[model samples]
Target chain A: MIKNKTGRIFEIIFYPLVSILIFLIIWDVGVKNSELSVVMPGPWEVVSKFIQSFAVPIGKYTMVYHILYSLMRVVPAYIVGSLAGIILGILMGWYPVINRILRPLYELIRPIPPIAWIPISIVWFGIGEGSKWFLIFLAAFVPITLNAYAGATTVDETLIKCSKMLGASDGQVFKTVVLPYSVPHIFTGLQVGLSTSWATVVAAEMIRSTEGVGWIIISSMDTNNVVQSLVGIMGIGVVGFILAIVMRKIEEVLCRWNRIET
Target chain B: MEQDRNLDIILKCENVSKKFQTKHRTKEVIGNINLEVRKNEFVVLFGPGQCGKTTMLNILSGLEKTTTGKVFLNDREVVEPGPDRGVVFQSISLYPWLTVMGNVEYGPKVRGINKKVRKEKAEYYIELVGLKGFENSYPNQISGGMKQRVGIARAYCNEPDVLFMDEPFSALDAQTRYLMQEEIMRIWEKEKRTVIFVTNNIEEALYLADRIILFTNCPTQIKKEYVIDLPRPRDYTSDDFLKLREEITENMAHTL
Candidate 1:
C-alpha cells in the first residue's frame, strides 16, 4: 500500500506534465500553422510575452503587482463574507425564529446573480475598490451561507440527543456537537466560496482598477492585444487551480476524523 | 433488606405514554408504562423490532418527553436531558470530530471540569472500556464495536446516576457482539452503575438482564417481567437458561 501510494504521488507530477505538454504542443503547432495566428498569436508567442510581462510593464506595473492587487481585493472580502455567512447561516439553521424572519429576504436575494449586482454595487459604493470588494463579497457570501446552513441544520439528530443525554446544555450542544458536526459542511462552503471569489475577480476588477489580472484582460482589450488577454486568463486558471488544492489540503488536515481509514 | 428496598430505587418511570399527532390520526408509541430500577441493577427492556423500545429509553434518559407521566431520578423529576443519565445509543453516536480521549472527556469538559481532573477521569474510563492505547484515535478509524466502547466510555466518564443503552450492541457482528456483552458485563461488575439496557435480541437480554421486562408492540407497555436469578457469567446453553429462554419465547406474543 505504501509503495503504491508513493508511485501514485510520482505519477501525479508525471501525468499532469504529460497532459499539459500535449495541450501546449497542440496549441503551439495549430496556431503557428493556421490562418487564425494573424488574430490569435501562437502559444509560444503568448507564453513568451507572458514571461516578458513579468519584467516589463503591461500597463503601469509588472505582472506580479497585478496579481497582488487582485489578491488584496479578493482576500479581505472573501474572509469577511465567508465568516459572516457562516455565522448567519448557523444562526438561521439553529433558530427557527431567525430562519422564519430572514429566509424570505435571503431567498429573494440569493437567486439574483452576483454579476447582476455590479451595476447596483457601482452605484452604491462608487467605481472604487469598495465596489470591487462588494462584488467579490457577494460572490463569496451566497454559496458559503447555503452550505453552512445545510451543515448546521442537518447535524445528526442522534448526536445532539447523545450530547444532551451526556448533560450538555443548549449552548453546550451547539458548541460541542453542532459546531463540530457542521465542520465538513462549512469547509465545503469555503471551498465553493473561494472559487466563486476567484471567478469574480475579473468582474470585480473590470469595474475600474489600475492593476490586477482582470485589468490585464480588460486593458489588453483596449489595445486589442488578444495574447495579453489570454495570458491574464492563463494566470487566473493556474492560480485558481492552486487555490483549490490548498483548500482541499486544509480540509483534509482539519477533518481527518471524517475520512474513512483504509 | 427492607431499608434497602425502601431507598434503593434509583430511577422510576411513572405512567409514561407518548403519542405523536400528524395531520390525521394520533399514533401512540408508548402506552402507559411504569418501571422502577434499583441501584446498580442491570434491567433489560426486551421487545421486538420497531416496538418503541428506543422511544421508551429516550424518555427514561430524558432525551424525549413523555406525552403523559414523568420520570424521577433520586426523587427529582427529569423534564429534560441532563448529564446525570448517560446514554449509549444503538447507532454509536461518537463525535467524529473528537478523538477517543476528547469524546470521553466531553461531558466533564462541558460541565466546567478542570483539564487535569477530567483527563484523569476520562483515562480511567477509557482503560475500563479496554481502549487504553487508543486515546487519540478517531471514531471512524475504529471498528463498529470499538465505537460503541467509546460511546460507553463517554457516558461513563460523566459518573451519571444511570447508564442507558438503547440496543447498543445490535450493530455489531455476532462475534463482536458476544465479546462486547462480556466486556460490558465485566465493566458493570467492577463499577456497578444502574444500567437500563434496551434490546430486541432475546439472547442479549437474557445474558445481560438481572430482570428482563418483556414489552409489547406499538402502543407499547410491559407484558411480563422475569427476575433471572441466574448465576453471573451465564452459560447460554445451560439447561436452566435454555428452559427460561423457551418459556419467554413461548409466552411472547408476535403480532405481524
Candidate 2:
C-alpha cells in the first residue's frame, strides 16, 4: 500500500509539471511568432505582473485586497444561502405538505437566471455590496436546494425502517439517517455552488464594486494593461482551485466511512 | 424441546392477517395466522417464495401492521416497532456510517441508556460475536459474512424479548450460511431468547427449530406444524434428520 501511494504521489506531481512545461513551450513559441502578445499576454508576462503587484502594498488596494474583498462578499452569502437552501430542501423533500406548498414557488423562481435579477437587486438594495451579495446568494442557492432535495427524497427506505426498529424517533431518524445519508450529494451541491459563486462574483463586482478581483480585471482592461488582466484571471482560477482542494479535504475527513469510487 | 413447551409464552399472534392495496388491486398476503413463541424457544416458519412468512414476521415485529387480529409481546399489544423486538434482515442492515461498535450501541442509545452502559453492552455483544478487535471498523471495511455478524451482534445487544430473523442468512454464500447457522445455534444456546426464524430452507428449519410451521403459497395459511424431536448438535447425515427433511420437502411439494 505504501509503495502504491508513493508511486501515485510521484505521478500526481510529475504529470502536471510535464503538462505545464509543454504548454509553456508552445505558448512562448507562439507569442514569438505572432502579434497575440498585445491581446493575450504570455505566461511570463502574467507572472511578472503578479510579482510586481505583490511587491507593492497600498491601502486596501493590492492584489490581496481585491482577493479578500471578493472572498468577503462570496463567503457569507454562500454560507447563508446554502445553509438555508439545505434546510428548506430537506423539509420540502421529507414532508408532503412542505413539498406541495414550496415546490411550485421554487420551480417558478429557479428558471429565472441569477443574472436576470441584477436590475431588481440594484433597485431594491442599490448598487452597493448588497446587490452583489444578493447575486452571489442567488448563484449559490438554486443548485444546493435542488441537490439537497433530491438527496433527502432518495434516502433508502429500508434504512429508515431499520432506524425506527431500533427505537429512533422521527426527529432522531431525520438527524441521523436522512442527514448523514444525504451528505455526499449535499457536498456535490456545495462544490457546484462554491464554483458558481466565484464565477458570478466577477460579474457582480464588475457591476457594482469599487474593489475586487473582478474590478481589478475591468480596471486593467480599461487601461489596456492586458498582462494585469490575465494575472487577475489566473488569480481567480488559482483561488477556485485552492477552494476546491480544501472542500475535498474536508469531505474526506468527514466521510471517512464512505467509499469513494475512482 | 420439552423445556420450550414448559416455558411461558413470550410472544403470541392471534389470527393475524395482512392485506395490501395497490393502485389497481387489493390482495391478501397472510390469512388468519396464529402462532405462539415460548420463552427461549427457537421456532422456524418454513415455506416457499410468496408464502407470507416474511409478512407474518414483519407483522409480529410491528414493522407491518396486520389488517386484522393482533400480536402480543408479553401480554402487551404491539402497535409500533420498538427495541423490545430486535430484527435481523436478509441483507446486512448495519448503518453504513457507523462502526461495528456504534451500530451495536444504536439501540441502547435510542432507548436513553447512559453512554457508558451502552458502550459496555455494545462491547459485550461485539465480543460475543467474535468481532472483539474490529470495534472501530466500519461496515464497508468488513466482509459480507462479517457484516452479517455485526448485524446479528447489534440485534442481540438490545436483549430483545423475541428476536425476529427474516431469512437472515439467505444472502450469504453456502459455506458462510452453514457457518452462520452454527454460530446462531451457539448464540441461541447461550442467550436463550425466544427466536422466530423465517426461511424457505426446509433443512435449516429442521436443524434449528424446536417447532416448524409450514405455510402454503401466496395468501398463505399454515398447512402443518411439526415438532422437531432431534437432539442438540443434530447431524445432517443422520437417518432421523434426513427422514424429517424428506417429509417436509414432500409436504411442501404437495402444497405447491
Candidate 3:
C-alpha cells in the first residue's frame, strides 16, 4: 500500500514535468525548422530574456516592478468590488422585493463586457488609476454577485425549515443558515472573478500606462521587439497561474467541511 | 380522572386534514387525524411507505398547515414552528458547516441562551446520544448513524415539550437500524420526553412504541391503534412479540 501511494505521487509529478519538457522541445524544433523563427523567438530565447529582465530594466523598471504595478491596480479594486457584490447579491437573492427592484437594471448592465466600458470609464474617471480601478471593479463585480445570488437562492429548503424548527427568526436564519450555505457558491464566484479581474488589469494597463506587463507588450510593438513582448506574456502567464493556485488553497481552507475526504 | 388525563396531554391535534392543489389536480394527502399525546408517552405512527405519515407529523409539529384543524401544545394553539417543538427528520438535516457541538447548540444560541449555558446543555445531550468525543467533528466526517445521533442531540438540547421523529432510522442499513432502535429506546427511557415516532416498520414499532397508531395510504387516516403492552427490551423472536407482530401485520395487509 505504501509502495502504491509513493508510485501514485511519483506519477503525478513526473508526468507533468515530462509533458512540459515535450512541449518545450516541440516549440524549439518547430521554430528552428520554419520561417516562424524570424518573428517568434525559440522558447529558450524567450525564457532566458524573461529571466534577464528581472535584473536588467526593460524600459524604466525591471520585470518584477511591472508585475507589482499590475497587482497594485488589481488587488484593491477586486477586494472592494467583491465585498459590495457579495452584499448586494445575497440581499437580492434572499428578499424578493429587493430582487424585483434591482434585477432589471442589473441584468441590463451584466452582459456588457468590462472592456466595452473602457471608452466611457476613461471619460468618467479619466486616463488615471481611477479608470483602471473602475474597469477591474466591473470585471470582478459581475461574476461574484451572480454566484452569491445563486448561492442564496438555492439554499436547501429543508435546511431553512430545520433552522426555523430550531427557533431561528428571519434575521438569525439569514446569518447562520443562508450565509454559510452561500459560501461555497461565493467562493466559486470569487475564483471566476479573480481570473476576470487579472485579465481586465492587463487590458486596463494598455490604456496609457508606463510600467506593467500589458505596457511591455503594447510598447514592444512600436520597437518591433518580439522578445520583450514574449517576456511580458510569460510574466502574465506565470503570475496568473500562481494567483489561481493561491485562490484554490484559500478556498480549500475556508470550505474544509464541504469536502468528503474518502 | 378525566380532567387529570386532559391536563396530562402534552400535545393534541383535532380534525386535521391536508390538501395540495397544484396546477394539474387537487390531491388529498391527509384525511382527518385526531390524537392526544400524554407526557412522556412513546407513540409510534405506523403505516406503509409514502402514506402521508410524514405530512401528518408535519401538521402536528406545525411545520405544515392543515386544511381544517387545530393543533394544541400544552393547551396553546400551534400556528407555526418554534423551538417549543423539535423534529428529527429522516434526512438527518445537520448543518454541513457546523461541528456536532455547533449543530446541537444552534437552537439555544439562536434563542439567546448564553454561550456557557448552551454549551453545557449541548455537551450533556451530546454525551447522552453517545457523541461525546466527537464534539468538533462536522456532519460529513461522521457516519450516517452518527449523524442521526447528532440530529437527536440537537432536538433534545432545545428542551421542547414534545419530540417528533419522522422515519429517523429508515435510511440506515438493517444492522444500524436495529442498533439505533436500541439507542433510541435507551435515550427515551433516560430522558422521558413525549416522543411521536413515525415509521413503516412493524418490528421497529413493536420494539419502541407504548402504542402504535396504524395509518392507511394517502388520503391517510387512522385505521387502527395497537396498545403494545410487551415488556421493556422485548425479544423479536419471543412467542408474544411474534404473535403481536403477526396480528398487526395482518391488520395492516387489509388496509392496502
Which portions of model 1 show Cα errors greater than 4 Å?
A: A1-8, A32-34, A260-262, B1-7, B254-256
Query: Candidate 1 versus the native: TM-score?
Result: 0.95
lDDT by residue for model 1 (A44-159), tens: 87788888878988889988898889899999999999998899899988998999999899999899888899999999999999999998998899899999999989999998
Ranking by lDDT: 3, 1, 2
For DockQ, the strongest prediction is: 1
Would you estimate the TM-scores of all the predictions? 0.95, 0.95, 0.95
Clashing pairs in 2: none
Residue A228's lDDT in candidate 2: 70
Better of 1 and 2 by DockQ: 1
- For each of the candidates, what fraction of the native contacts does it recover? 0.84, 0.61, 0.77
lDDT (Cα, tens digit) per residue for candidate 1, span B162-214: 99998898888999999999999999988888999998888888999889999
Residue A128, candidate 3: alpha-carbon lDDT: 92
lDDT of 3 by residue, A65-124 (tens): 999999999999999989988998999999999999999988998999999999999999
List TM-score (chain A only) for every prediction. 0.94, 0.91, 0.94
Backbone clashes (count) for model 2? 0
DockQ value for model 3: 0.74
For model 2 chain A, where is the 10-residue window of minimal lDDT? A51-60
Q: Cα deviation in Å at residue A92, candidate 3?
A: 2.2
Better of 1 and 2 by lDDT: 1
Model 2 Cα lDDT, one tens digit per residue, A22-82 = 9878998898779986667777877777777666642247778878899998999999889
Off by over 4 Å in 3: A1-18, B1-7
Candidate-wise lDDT, in order: 0.89, 0.87, 0.92
